[model samples]
Target: MKKLVILGAGTAGTMMLNKLYKVLDREEWELTIVDQYKTHYYQPGFLFIPFGIYKKDDVIKPKSNFFPPGTNVIFSPIDRIVAKENKVLLEGGKVLNYDYLIVATGTETRPSETEGLKDKLWYKDIFDFYTIEGALELHKRFKDWEGGDLVMCIPELPYKCPVAPLEFVFLADDYFTKKGIRDKVNIKYVTLMSGAFTKPVASKMLGELLAEKNIEVIPDFYLSSVDNDEKKIVSYDEREIPFDILTIVPVNMGSDMIERSGLGDDMNYIPTNKHTLQSDAFENIFVIGDAANIPTSKAGSVAHFAAEILTENLLSAIEGRPLDAKFDGHANCYIETGQGKGALIDFNYETEPLPGTFPLPGIGPFGLLKNTKINHYGKVMFRWIYWHILLKGRELPIEADMSMAGKYRV
Candidate 1:
């Protein structure tokens, strides 16, 4: 039987596995998946851990729980992908050859990439919510801590969940206020972007919200290093900001195995056809989610949308037909604002987030570009949807390609 190998059992890979498993002819194709970890993390839930909205138990489950029965799941680190040979070399010297390969190994935080970031003060004064350990540590620190200078910094771009830093500061505002230390806690949002966000309209809206919340926004600050001894983060231009508590989004990079494979870019992201989600170097290889160097938000929503398009394209390719399905780079995010409210944004490659209703042209239960309690509820309910529907390869009401029906230009 021809072999189909999937690398990385993360969200993208798991979704694809389920989607294809139901459709692929088991008699003709042998399906297999590999990953290094035994646990599956709800990465988005990590954002809430520091705020006590979620606990360690809420974000984790066995990797086996998500895999479909009869799957040839191998828990092992990948050494490298030999694309020309159509083979994957695992760390244990096991070799697997494939007729088709799907790379969904996602990006990861590299705190060490920034000087002094992972130093002695790490998990003491400095923490990152991108990882479970960091989030749990920060939660512990926040429990007994009196508020001081709480600084949220984004050291790089293309990080997972672009709105998370903003959400962190927003939630921090609420958390400290409830603790009755809001007055003592001076929250500052430090970002490398020119504004609160990358897009203009959304940035303006979020920037105004930050100001209203009395959260200082320091823009264009490129983080150079952390001065663990002095408790300050220094920027490339030599500006230093001292903080009592520093929460940061570290530099993110694709899997190291991508680097070894020589199939990746400077950042170790695979060169993929943005529209097709297919590797540019190999016709039989496809990349999904954070692994592909696609110009879109590296969030689960993008992966979910891309999976639908990819499923269609892959099946077409299997039949020796032209790949007709195209991904439109659709991404949507819920920005949690303080006080039980959140804002939503939906856009594709050609469109920036705009103001209007969502899913339904004029009658959305969830507002677009507007902060509302209902949007927060939508985000809260998504966790259930993620575990039950999304990972199971079930179809959502939303379309794969972005629709302009409910959005309006500002």
Candidate 2:
């Protein structure tokens, strides 16, 4: 039997396993998935973890629960990928050969990448919500905390869920208001980008909202290092922003194995054909999710869209046919804007977010690029859909390709 090996049983890998399991003939092909951890995290829920909206247990489940029974699930850390030999070497010294390989190993937070960021003040005054431990620790610190110079900063771009840091700032504003400490807190958002967001029109809208909320915005601040003792972030240009409490979204990079295999770019992301989702270095290998150096948002929705195209392309390749299925960098994200309202944005490689009614053009239950309660509910309801539908590889009502049907083009 031909071996089909998938690395990292996270959202992307798990979904692919389910999709391919039903399609690949069991007698002729064998599927194997490997990951170091036993538990799977609903990563999107991590955004709410620091706000006490979601407990750690609420976002975690056994990795084995979602995987197909027939596929071999191995809990082992990958030491390196010997791509030349078409094999993965685990930490335990086991070598697994593959007829075809899928690299879904996702990105990770590198707090140490910034000097002094992980020093004495880490988790005391500085915290990150990207990891489970950091979120839980921040939750505890936020409970008894009185407010002062509360700064939410993003060190650089291409971070997981580009809007997450903005969401954190919005949620923090609401949290402090509810705790009766809003008056005492000076809320500030510092980012490397030129505006509140990457896109110009959306950034303008969001910037206006931030001003109305009285949250200060500091743009074009390229963070060089953190001064833990002084409680300030120093930029490469020598500019400094002082903070009483700092919530940081640090540097994000792809899996270490990609670097070890010499198959990744400067940020450790594999160089993949943006439309094909196939590795530029090898035809038999493919990359998806945060592992691919694609221009789309490093988001779950992008991965879902990529999976649809990849499924078709993989089948075509196996049949010695041309791969015609193309990924258009589709990404849909819900921005939680505090107070019981949220905004939705949908776009692809060639398009920026625009104002529109979503899913059903004129009769949308959700609005795009505008804050609404319906969008908030959609954001809240996604957690249920993630475990029940997305990870299970079930088809969702939304189309895989970006749609202009419900969107209003200017």
Candidate 3:
């Protein structure tokens, strides 16, 4: 029997396991998935946790609840990937050899990378929304506190759910308004980018929204270090921004195992073919999720799209055939603009987001590049789809490739 080992039983790995379990011959193939975590987090829900929209129990589940039978689930941390020998070294020095390998190891926030950021102020005056602990702590801090300079900052880029930081400020604006403290709280946004977002058009739109909300922005501010003692953040350009309460999105980096294996770039992301999702280092080793250094938004929707094409490519590689499917970096996300409204965007590697209808060109219930209440409902309902349909490898209404049928040029 041929051995197939998938590392990190996150979104990508779990979906691939369900997809392949039904197709691959049980007698000819044995599959195993390894991860140190027993709880699976609904990472997208982290943005809502601080707002009290999602509780701790709402965003997590046991890993065993999702995995289908016929696959071995090992709960252990990985030490390194031996790509040359096609084996994996676990923390306890146990080795597992495989004929084929899939790397779905995802990224994590590293606040320690920034000097003084993780100092005394962390979780007290300073908080982050990327992890459950941070989100829960911020929730308590927001409940009984008086208003001051509420600063939301992103230290660097290439973070998961790139729209989340924007969503955080939006919700904060509305939350304070409802509490009758909107005038007392001065909201400020500090980002490393030159605009509100990565894309030029979207940045302009979001930037204008920030202005209308009376939110101050300090663009092109590269974070150098945090002065926790003074409650100020210093930038590389030597500018200082004082904050009473700081909510930050820390520097995100790929798995340490990728770095240990010598298969990743400076940021620890694996060098992968943008279209094929196959590792450039080894033909048998494939990558998905935030682990691959792909030029696209590191979001969950991208993982679902990549898994569809990757399953086909995996079959092609195993059978010694040329890969037929090519991923187009198709990614769509719901931007929670607060007050029972949200905005949606759909685009690929070539096209930028523009106004249009989605799913059905002319008859979309969900508008593109436009804020709508239904879009907010879609965001609320996606939790059900993620648990029932997505992890089961069931097909969604959307396709893997981008469609220009209803979209106009941005």
Candidate 4:
């Protein structure tokens, strides 16, 4: 029987496994998945953990819980992917050959990459909400903390969930207000980008919101190092920003196995076709999620959309046919603006977010590019949807392709 191997049992990998398992004939194919970790994290919930909205238990589950029955699941660290030989090397010197390979090895935080950032002040004064441990630790620190120079800084770009840092700042404002310490807290949002966000219109809206909330916006400040002893962040140009409590979004990079295999870009992401999701270097190999260096948000919604297109293309390749399905880089995100409200944005490669009703355009219960309580509820409800529907590879009510049906073109 032909073998199909999937790396990483995270969101993207699990979704693809479910989608392909039903379609691929079990009589002719054997499906296998491999990962080093036994637990799976609901990554989006990580953003809410620091604010005491979610506990560590709410965001974690066994990796094996979602795998379809009859498929082989292995818990082992990958040593390298020998693409030339079409096999993977495990740490114990075991080699697994594959007829086809799907790489969903996701990105990781590299806090150590920044000098002094991981020093004595790391969890004490400097914290990151990207990981469960960091988020949980920050929660305790914020409990009794009197407000001071609270800085929310982005160390670099191409991080997972780009809007999370902004979300952190907004939630912090709300958190402090509840504690009656809003008057004492001085919130500053420092980013390497020139605007509040990567997209132009969204940035303008979000930037204005920051200003209205009295959150200082510092753009174009590239982080150089952290002064643990001095309690400041030094930029490459020698600019210094002092902070009493520092929240950082550390540098994000793909799996180290990519670097060891010598088959990835400088950031260790595999170069892939933007539409086909197939690796540029090999036709028999495909990449998805944070593993692919596609010009799209490395967010969960993108993975869901990509899985639909990828499954179609993978079948085409197996049948020796042309791949006809095209992926338009569709991505949607709910921006939590705090105070029991949120904003939603939907766009693709060619379009920026425009104001309109979503899912039914003219009749949307949810508005796009505008803040609403409904959007906030939608954001919160996603955790349930993620576990029950998304991971099961079930089709959502929304279409895979970006649509203007319910969106207003201004």
For candidate 4, list the clashing residue pairs, or say none.
361-406
**TM-score of predicted model 1?**
0.99
Candidate 1 residue runs with Cα over 4 Å from true position: none
Return the lDDT, model 3, position 266.
Answer: 93
Candidate 3 residue 300 Cα shift, in angstroms, is 0.5
Looking at model 3, residue 170 earns an lDDT score of 93
What's the C-alpha lDDT at position 394 in model 1? 90
Worst 10 contiguous positions by lDDT, candidate 4: 401-410
For residues 1-410, what per-residue lDDT tens digits would candidate 2 score against the true structure?
A: 89989999999999999999989999999999999999999988988988889999999999998998799989999998888899999997999999889999999999999999999999889999999988888999889888789999998768899989889889999999999999999999999999999998789888998988899999999999999888999999999999999999989999888899899999999999999899999988999999999998999999888999998888888888998999999999999999999999999999898888888898888898898999999999999999999998999988888988778766
- After superposition, the stretches of candidate 3 with alpha carbons farther than 4 Å from their true spots are none
TM-score for all models, in order of appearance: 0.99, 0.99, 0.98, 0.99
Q: Ten residues in a row with the worst lDDT in model 1?
A: 61-70
Candidate 2: worst-modelled 10 consecutive residues by lDDT: 401-410
- What is the lDDT, from 0 to 100, of the residue 109 in candidate 3? 93
How much does each candidate deviate from the true structure in C-alpha RMSD?
0.8, 0.9, 0.9, 0.9
Candidate 3 lDDT score at position 159: 92
What is candidate 1's lDDT per residue for 84-126, written digit by digit as tens?
Answer: 9999999989999999999999999999899999999999999
lDDT of 3 by residue, 340-372 (tens): 998888888998877788878888888887889
Best by lDDT: 1
